[model samples]
Structure formats: C-alpha cells, structure tokens
Target: MGFKFDWFMKGMLGAVLLAFLWPEPGAKGGFLQPELLNKLGVALVFFLNGLALSLASMKDGALRWRVHLLVQCSTFLLFPLLGVALLWGSAGWMAAPLQIGFFYLCALPSTVSSSVALTIAARGNVAAAVFNATLSSLIGVLLTPLWMAWVLHQSGGNFAVGPVIVDLLLWVVLPLVLGQFSRPLLKDWASRHKGLLQKVDRITILLLVYTSFADTVKEGVWSRYNPLLLLQTVAGCALLFLLVLALTQWGARLLGMPRGDRIASVFCGSKKTLASGVPMAHLIFGANPAIGLILLPIMIYHPLQLLAGGMLAQRWSSAEAAPS
Candidate 1:
C-alpha cells in the first residue's frame, strides 16, 4: 500500500536501461520496433478501458457538476499552467528537452487505478473518482495533443496536427468507443477478468516504452544527461506535483465541494498516469530519442505521487467517514 511497483513503471525503467545497452529490440526494423503491433497495443489499452467503465457510475458522478468540473479543470487547466510557471521559474536551470517533457507531464490525464485506490483509502467519493479519472483519459486523448501542438507551434517546434488527431482517434477514441458499445456483451467477462485485463494494459504500455526508448537510444541521446540533471528533473517533478496537490485541495474547498468529493479532487486531480503517458508519447512523438528524456519527469513523478498520495490518503481517511 505504501510504495507499490507498477509493472508498467518497472517495465519502463527496464526499457530505458535496455535501450541504452542494446537499443535493438525496441528500435525500428527490430523485432520489437512496434509498427502494426504498437497500434494494436494502444487500441487494446483503450478498449479495455471502455470495457471497465460503468455507465451508471459515470451518470451519477457527472451529476456532481462542481466536483467534476473542479477535478477536470485542475487536471487539464491548472496542471498546464503550473508547468508553464515552472518552465519560467527554471528558465536557466532546465534544458529545453526537460522543459518540453515537463510540459507534456502537465497535459497528461490522472491515473485511474491509483487515483481510485487512494480515494477509497482517503474515504473519498470513489464512484466520482472512477467517473472522473476515466473521463480524464478520454479527454486527454484530445486535449493533450491540442496543448502540445499549440505550444510547439508557438515555439516553432515541429508538430503535425492532422496526423496527431487521426492517430489519436484511430488508436485511442475509436477503440474506446467500440469497447463501450460492446460492453453489454463483454461486461461479465471483463468484470471477471479485470485483474488479468489490467495486466494486459500494463504489458501494452511496457511494449510502447520499449519501442520509444529503443528509438531514442539509437540516437545516442543518453549521452547528454548526467546524474545531476536527472536529480534536478526529479526535483522538478516533485515540486510540480506538490504545488498542484496543494492548489487542488485549496480550490476544492473554495468551490464548496463536500469532503468526500474534495478528496477525489485532490487525489485524482494531482496524479499523472505513466500507463497512458508512455503509449501516448510514443504515439505522439514516434520513437523520438528525446522521448526517453520526455518521459523522465513522468517516470519519477509516478512513484512520488503514489507515495505522497498514499501518505495523504491515510491522513485524509481518518478525518472523514468511509463512503457507503
């Protein structure tokens, strides 16, 4: 409960190291270069996501408009703003790659599993957590790209808007909608196999990581980063997370959301998902070696959020009654 190993996270760590050493397995024209395999994996991630969603839960959760709006805005709006502020504050400190990566981190969606788990631990609105977290992933498929594209365009970085939207719709939304449409047929099977299915999602993410890093390592990208820079990146991720966590808590209370919903806002709004991030990055950036660097902040943030959120949940749960 305190610090858990997200298999996908561990896989991503392994992937970077492996890419650094060999770079063949995950590289283009290699056995694991992705190609059609990557598309299938991403599609499967969202398909399973759709299968796991409960329409009734989403409906009920949506009715809490204030809570829902707060969480979504905190995630999509506030997080990006904080990232920009951090970029400004660290102007001389952070490199361009790190800055871009950090900005991407801000644009990511909340983690569905960890957010909901922490919400339950904190005695928050778990149903709302589920609804909002799931909704965030769906929203992220569209929003993250738009933000990234606009930012990159403003900065004169390369961005292909048309292809990005096409890829997202094909790999993310399309599969998701298909799964939702077929949920009535697969609901019982999905429910029973939830544990296994979740593993599948992790494995798919791991595959994406391998391909992403493989692409990067081939370019000798790791040569640029030293231990000091790595440590600073971690520090940057921690600072961004802590600041957003504090802000979400304050905003939730100010919005007059109830205690249960506030916990969900704080937990879900504060998290960024490696599961969704890695694959989406690969999809968006396509094996750019800098992706390993791009994913760096998120890789560090994943565990920090888990550990920090767990500690906060333990404290928050004691203050409120567990939901029915």
Candidate 2:
C-alpha cells in the first residue's frame, strides 16, 4: 500500500501558510470574529468528547491500575521533569517564548483520538487506551494550568489563575459535563455519526491554529525569531517524543507487562494533545500574540508522533500476525 499523507496535518500546515499570507480574516477584530468561533470550537470539542465517552468501557479499563499509572506518570511527571531539565540546561542558549512552548508541550495530556487510534492499530488494550486518554484530558484541565502558571512566573510573566480556572471550568469542564449528561439521550446518535463528530473536532483544531497564527503574524511575533530557530525547535520536539517513548517502553518491559498493555502504555504516555493544548493556550494567554509562539513545540510534536506511531503500529500489527 502506498503511504497516505494525513489530510488534517496538511490542512494545519496550510492554515499556517494562510495565516502568513492572509491573516486578516482570522486575526482579532477581523471580519471572521475568530475569537467567538474559537470559544465555540473549544466548547464543541469538549462537548462532543463527553457525549462520545463510553462509561462501560471506562469502567472496564479502570481495572488496569498499573497501565493507567504508568501512562499518567509519564505524561504529567516524566515529561515535565524533562522539560524543566532542558529549560535549565538551555537557559543561556534558547529563546524565552520558545522555552515556554517547550515546557508547555511537556506538561500536556495524552492525545485522546490519535493515541487510541494508534493503540488499536497496534493491537493494544483498546479499553485501557480509551480510559487513559480520557483521564489524561480531564486531569490536564487542572495540571496544564498549574504547570503553565509556574512557567509564566519563572519567565516573569503574569498568570491570573483565578480567572483562567474560571474560564476553563466554564468553557471546558462545563461543556464536557453537559455533553456527558446529554449522552443518555444522544449516545446512539453520536455513535452513528462518529465520523462526522471526528471531523468537527479536527476542524475546530484547525480553526484554532489558524486564528492563533493570524494573531501572531498580525502582531509581528515571528519577526523577532528566525527560521533556523524553528528548525531547532522542531528537533527539540522530536527528541522529547523519542525520550518519552523510550522511557515508557522501558518501564513497561521492566514491569513485565503483556504486549498489549505495553503498547497501550507506550503510545498513550508518549502523546501530547495538540487539540487540548491550543484551546487551553488561548484561555491562558488571552490575546497575547505570543500565544502562537507558545504553541510551536506541540504543533511540531503532534505530527512527529503520528508519523512515528503509525510506523510502529504497522510493525507491531505485523509481528502479532506472524507465526510463532
């Protein structure tokens, strides 16, 4: 089979280019009213997420404590510690906004969709993947903010936690709860239109990316940085993915986990959600043009994980099919 390029990824890159060439529509105070759309997109994504969640599957996956613990720790702890170490080591060398982006990338939750999709392709414990990915996103609402607050403080920037938390609860948590409650009435319909719902999620993310880069470009945020710096940041994002992936694999092996559980842990633990990251950045940074700059690391990291995870899943799938 021929390799297929990810359409959503291509769309994202195009969105960035569009922002560069013609950012007028998406920028703040522009004709599109992207700010209003962004807010709606955030709420819509979470509501769809809540509506799609499977309570029974979640219960079943919850029994695997070891797998869950490893995924959560690698996501929230191992990655963040690595970010801090990198920041400390690169103190004199790297740019500040990019530094914050890198750390924020580290603290993000496991991606809900891609993580589960890759796990299933790899013949992993699907239930556990679903549970862990969902759990990570929920917990990230709280943890990501806390981590960003510290990063902002360290960089001498301000973070009003009270307002940010209120916004998150209002836009993120509240919509999610409503969606989950609506599931009793909407689950069958949601399940039937899964493909459409997934598209909605992807489109919202693309919209967020477009508006953010538009704001950044309009404010001349990229003028201060060079293309070479971006190349380096891409390298940094790739390295971070590799390091966490290796750690998760090693931890799974040391615990003598079954192959299925190990695949679940490795994939789920290594992913950082660009979907959640972008919306949260908007809430946290407001209209600061640097919000786009702060999103660079995860934007770079997302595709890297998808490419690598796809290859790994194919290999694992073939291995599982082989005769002993």
Candidate 3:
C-alpha cells in the first residue's frame, strides 16, 4: 500500500496510460480484441485463485464467527447504506452514473493482502484480518453483482439480475469452484508458483481497466467530467471512509471487542478492495459508455484509503507501543 510501485501496479498504470493515449488496441474490435481477453483473464484469475487459496487456513480463521460477522457486515451492508444516503443527497451535485459509482465503491470487499498487512503493522488481529479479508472477497464474488443489480434495477436501468447472476457464476464463481475442487491436484504446484499466480490477478484487473477506460474514452467520458467533479469525488470518498472508520470503531466498542479485534475491525471493515472492484465493474457495467464515470469514485478511493490507512496504522501502532 506504500507509494512505491509493485511491477504489477506499474503494469496496471501502464495499461491505463496506454489505453488513454492510444485506445485502438483495447477499442471495440472483432472477437480477438481486448474485450475477449478480459473475459478469459477474469476466468483465469479466479481459477488460479482457487488453486492458491489455503482452505485449511481459511477454516481455521472461520472459527472467529463474531469478528467475521462484524467485518463482513461493515463491508457489505453498512458501507452501501451510507453510500446510498450520500448519493441521494449528492444527486444534484454529482452526475447520475458517478453518483451511483460512489455507492458502488462502498459495496466492494476488503483488500486481501493489504488489510492483513496493515493490521499486522497496527498490531491488530492478523489471523482475523486474513479470515475476514478472504471471506469478504468470496462473499463479494456474489454480493457485489447482486448489489449492483439491485441498485441499478431500482434506478430503472436495463441491468437484469438473472443475467448478472448467470454471468458472475460463469466467469467468476465457476472458475473459483473449479479451482477449489481441483486444489488437491494442484495445491502443491500452486504454492510453488504463488508469486506468478498473483501476477495473474494483477494482470486480470489491469486488462479490465484498460478495456473499460478505452471504451469510455471512445465514448468521450473524460469530456463530461471536469476538475471540480474530480475533486468532489476525492473529498466525498475521504468523508465516506472517515464515517465508516468512526462507525466501526464505535460499533466495536459497543460490542465489547478487544483492542486487537477492534483494530482488525477498523482496518478490515473500513477499507475497500480496488483489485476486486475494477474487474467486477466490467462484469456489471459491460459495454456501458459511461463506464469510466462509474469508476471515478473507485479510482479515487483506492489511493485515498491507502494514504489514510497508512497514517492511521502508524499512529495506532505507535500508540500501542507506548506504556499506558
């Protein structure tokens, strides 16, 4: 989550930059274009994930049901509720797609790696962090699409829940299930090639970003958005993050969670996963001209959460180290 670039993130930025500058590669083309690659990449990414997951570790973490419930509720339920309220109030200021996009950001799952990493840095419950983070992603595989379908349907859009669910099961869920079932045969090999598989996850997300942005660019998405809307998106996301962080902290204390559990709750519950968000956007918003606008809040929220979480983790860690 630091400012330093991982080669994967760099590739992500490069893909977006390339798409922005010259979108012809990712632009609408025949069957062999970037769009088709995105579909295959999505399947491949989830399948590899199925191989790489440690079911035993996930099971071990599952025993902490209360903590897990809190984190997932905060991630899936509370965030979206708050986002709805904000989007409702901001409709005048924010455009239609962007307003809903902000709400979409709230419904994303917690980051798998960074949530645990930040929890460890803050002296939080790392095992619970891992458990909740993993569980959040798995849940999001279904929940995110359902949430999007509901939200869009409520807004009277053409997004059909049946189709959305079918697509998710086919592209995301099926591959994951296949990978899980195939784990016995491939687990050892997956562990050996873990680093390489993670790169696949990064690449899948990048390709989705490239193609989505390229489509939006062709539709003149950037032309509609201005400097003020961009700034507003940042401010709104920061405020939303603060609100979630504060509420989770209060909720933890009310539930009599320990300091470690409280720390995990705050970090895991308050943060959203960009890695998952970008790809899911493609699945949900498929070929929408305003896809770029829908991603604005999410793109802004990613870095904001990192910087905010980094500072908060350092301060909390320092406080924990001090004698009371």
Q: Largest lDDT belongs to which candidate?
A: 2
lDDT tens digits, residues 1-324, model 3? 344446765776787788789877776782338667867877887787677666677665666666887899999999999987986788677888788788889888888877888898899888888889988989998888778778787777887777767778888898989999999998888889888778777877877788877887877877876668878888898899999989999988888888888888888998898877876777788768788778878887877777888888888999999998
Could you give candidate 2's per-residue lDDT for residues 256-323 as a string of tens digits? 88999999999999999998898888888766788788898999898888889999999998999999
Identify the runs in model 2 with alpha carbons over 4 angstroms from their true place: 1-4
The local lDDT score (0 to 100) that residue 282 gets in candidate 3 is: 73
Ranking by lDDT: 2, 1, 3
Task: Order the numbered candidates by TM-score, best leading.
Answer: 2, 1, 3
lDDT of each: 0.83, 0.89, 0.81
lDDT (tens digit, per residue) of candidate 1 on 1-324 = 366775665776787787778888767788764677778888988888878877787776777777788889988999988887877787776777788899999999988989999998888898889889988987898899998887778768889889888998898888989989989999998889889998888888777777777777887777766768788888888888888888898999899998899988888899998888887886788745687788888888988999998889888866564465
The candidate scoring highest on TM-score is 2
- Candidate 1 stretches with Cα past 4 Å from truth are 6-8, 321-324
Model 1: how far residue 254 lies from native, Å: 1.2
